[model samples]
Target: MRAPYASDPATARGRRVPEDESSFRSCFQRDRDRIIHASAFRRLKHKTQVFVEHEGDYYRTRLTHSIEVAQVARTISGALHLNAELTEAVALAHDLGHPPFGHTGEDALEKMMAPYGGFDHNAQAIKIVTSLERHYAGFDGLNLTWETLEGIAKHNGPVTGDLPHALADYNALHDLELDTHASAEAQVAALSDDIAYNNHDLHDGLRAGLFSEDEIAALPMVGPAYAEVDRVHPGLDSYRRRHEALRRVFGVMVSDVIETSRALLDDAGATSVADIRHVGRPVIRFSDPVWAELREIRQFLFTRMYRAPSVMKIRAEVTEVVEELFVLFLGRPDLLPKHWARAVSAAGGDKLLLARMVSDYIAGMTDRFALQEHARLIGDG
Candidate 1:
């Protein structure tokens, strides 16, 4: 049997989402099915999570990341006795907001649209569910439940020191029912994102030779983890060859969350983000030691994988391409999509709306599309 918290109905603080299945799946599972079938989810296969979309045959694409998140969240949720359906749905849709080319595209577009309303993948994901991509109901978007929308927003939320989005700020309305339903699942999704990416990014970096097994072992808790990795699969660990190593890493993530939550259940009401606080992070979280190690690994990745000469060669080139293309499109102004000019909510008239619209459009483009457009307009034979 599942843990007893599966039926929890707390508040936005940490609660169980009510669900009723029709003939097959529970409501949240149905939501997951709809997301899986959506064009947006399919498009994620070709989108970026960290690296360029399609740049490497073995790199994790956005779709793989989403699937992995779902797996991690589901396992964690099960262990914690949270509603698995809600956890899985939240994990699957959390990154639906990210634009192509990962943060590279997100940043370029954010700058271009700063005048209108700075672009953000989270807000954009909400927009996609609420209004974009018209389908059968004569509605462009998916019409996801309010609970799902709230989970998407609170997944990572407005990071520290950042202003909230207009939607979040102006319509910060809190519906008790939706709040009660979204809390646990949202946390599961958020924590899963961290857990999945941290471990996988490390493995990916190691495979890329951005760092050696020995180098990673020298960083933070990486020594023991690297030893565990080697012990799990002692052979050469290439992206193509480390199949067993990859599975071991995934297993570590599942066990970490499960054991961490079980250990912290007594701290369910801790006071602060730093207070050795609540079990399960009130949403998605890990134990103190696990989190500390992940943080150090994150710092190391920034220095090794991201700032290395090889990755910089691509980042420098992509940064130029993204910024140049944004300027060109914003300069022309008329290239704005017809829907954007007409349907936008901004009252600053067509020009402002067009800029935001252009940013969204560019942000939405896949790495290949962005590159092709940039080359067509800026590159010479």
Candidate 2:
């Protein structure tokens, strides 16, 4: 049984483009299913998370990372008696806007499109569900429910400042209430993302030899987890040792969030999803100690893994690919895919509109496809 404050599908705000309810699925379940089947969702398979897609099979691609986030989200939401389906839907769709080479591609796209309204993955995600993912004959986008759209728009927190153009455009048509906290389920999904990425990056970095067990041994949560693994399994193989240690660290983080959130919810006394949203503070979060320790861990990964020499070299190369593709498409829209070219031509000589279309086309590419297109159009030699 869910808590009183849980988002009830019966009271859901409903989708922008109305449709008949499914007999077997809750509205949120249908949302999750639609997101799973989206072409953009499938493209995440080859998009990088930390390591490039071609680096190794063990590294987390965007698709794997999203799946992990969903797993964590469901676990947290289920424990909190929140809507696990809505949380999973948000988690799965969160990274759909991430371009070819993860953050590198996003940064490059932001730079290239600075004059045409900056690119933001969060806002791009909102755009994708509302206008870009044209799966239905009646609508341009998926026409997801309001709660899901709000979760996608402000899952990180309230958007009080100038919104991204993509988000702004949609908000004009149907306001997502960007200036308040999301549902508890959405809050759970957001924190779950933090838990998944921080833990997975440590595991991936260890496997990549970007950093050693010794390197992470001093970090908070890492130290105790490793010490326990060593105490229990002396002289274990490197693979098993790393796995055991990281799993312990992951457990600690998850436990911290759940315990902290439970206390916060009790204090807030929110009796409905609206009450949870308007409470003026997040109901889901890590404890103060855990948050600080996570900051240290993130700094370690940023310095030793994200900015390592090998990763930086690839970052530079992929940034160039994104920039060149953006400029090439802007200069010669005719070179875009036939369907994209038709869309550009239909813009009726609006360069800004053409640029935005090019941005969408380029942002949807997979890493391998982006590299191939770069070589094909700009030539590797």
Backbone clash count, each prediction separately: 5, 0
Off by over 4 Å in 1: 1-23, 157-166, 169-182, 225-249, 263-266, 269-283, 336-349
Q: What is the lDDT of residue 170 in candidate 1?
A: 24
**What lDDT would each prediction earn against the true structure?**
0.65, 0.92
Per-residue CA lDDT of candidate 2, range 117-202, in tens? 88999999988988889879999888889999889888999997877789889999998899999999999989999999999999
- Candidate 1 TM-score over all chains jointly: 0.80
Tens digits of per-residue lDDT, candidate 1, 288-352, equal 77677777878988998878898777777777887887777767655555666554446344676
Model 2 root-mean-square deviation: 0.9
Question: In model 1, what are the clashing residue pairs, if there are any?
Answer: 132-140, 133-140, 134-140, 187-283, 187-284
Candidate 2: what lDDT? 0.92
Each candidate's TM vs. the true structure?
0.80, 0.98
Error of 2 at 162 (Å): 1.5
- For candidate 1, give the lDDT of residue 68: 90
Off by over 4 Å in 2: none
